[model samples]
Target: LPHRYPFLLIDRIIELDIPNLKVKALKNVTVNEEFFNGHFPEYPVMPGVLIIEAMAQAGAYLMIKKLKAEGADGDFTVLFAGIDSAKFRKPVRPGDQIIFEIEGLNIKKSMGKIKGVAKVDGQVVCEAVLMAALKKS
Candidate 1:
């Protein structure tokens, strides 16, 4: 990803199925996070928007990896075009590890749509449908 520390929410790509257009990634939430300090110094719950961002990052990873496998060339970056049906079911806090599962719903040319779900301890915390555009950087 083009993100750096404190912004790059994805910690690892645990699974990738290129042919299936699916990916699974992890993000370990910690009290040391900068957002935690401002989001809530006392309670420290992870922001809902960041969870959605994490899902988007996972989807971006899947698209990038697929492009690589297909021998596509270009310094590309994925940018959010839209987010739909986003729902936050539970709060995420320090010491929680979020697992993002993203599946491509439609991908053609520069536009793509993906369904993403964020889970902690096998329970869904958030889910959304993300739309993005792949642009050459």
Candidate 2:
């Protein structure tokens, strides 16, 4: 939450179903966002990579919450290991709020697989299969 601009893709966590290992997150897009300026002035669309980043953020949040709930006492950092089977179905533009939904596919001690989707106005804009590593912070 203390993270700064550009790095912070997640706006809020809407739901956390720990038993299902599922979470819903959001990112509000605005014209004032820096990326729009360079991503293309005439045709501004959120980058595909940023969409993936948003999904990763959701996965990281879920992992942190799960660990803390179990009273695990170690500093941890989550890092992206890989992304697969990613697809962009629609373009996301400014003034749109993207809903990022992610669910754990499998969880290991230090690594896990998750599936994510980015949606806007009830439409899926992008989705991916993500792998991340959780390590000591």
Candidate 3:
């Protein structure tokens, strides 16, 4: 978590549905964000890639949390194995509350699959299918 900088993407995780292996997190976007300066000077807009990254981070957090709950110790890293069928449906601007939701599809010994979505004010902003794997520390 400390590794994140320039304002963390995740503000808080509201729900963790263990039975379904799903998680819900939030990110508050503001106009003063640094990325807006270069992304566009006149027509500032949040980058689409960042939206996907935010979703991916939420998914990673869930995987790490589950691993920790299962009594896994030491430093274990979860890496993004692949991104499939990612789509940016709408532009996410400042002053938006992005609700990120991720569901665990399959979790094996080291690899896992998750379906993630980012919503702004109850509207879908982005969605993606992510595959991740745990790496040896």
User: Worst lDDT window (10 residues) for model 1?
Assistant: 67-76
State residue 108's C-alpha deviation in candidate 2, in Å: 2.5
User: What is the lDDT of every predicted structure here?
Assistant: 0.92, 0.88, 0.84
| TM-score, cand. 1 | 0.96
Q: What are the models' TM-scores?
A: 0.96, 0.95, 0.91
Tell me how many residue pairs clash in candidate 3.
0
- Residue 27 error, candidate 3, Å: 0.6
lDDT of 2 by residue, 1-137 (tens): 33457789998999998789999999999998889999989999989999999899889888777777767787778889999999999999999999998998986658878999999999999999999898877
Deviation from truth (RMSD, Å), model 2:
1.3
Off by over 4 Å in 1: none
State which candidate, 1 or 2, has the greater lDDT.
1
What is the alpha-carbon lDDT for the whole of candidate 3?
0.84
Q: Tell me which residue pairs clash in candidate 1.
A: none
Off by over 4 Å in 3: none
Which numbered prediction scores highest in TM-score against the true structure?
Answer: 1
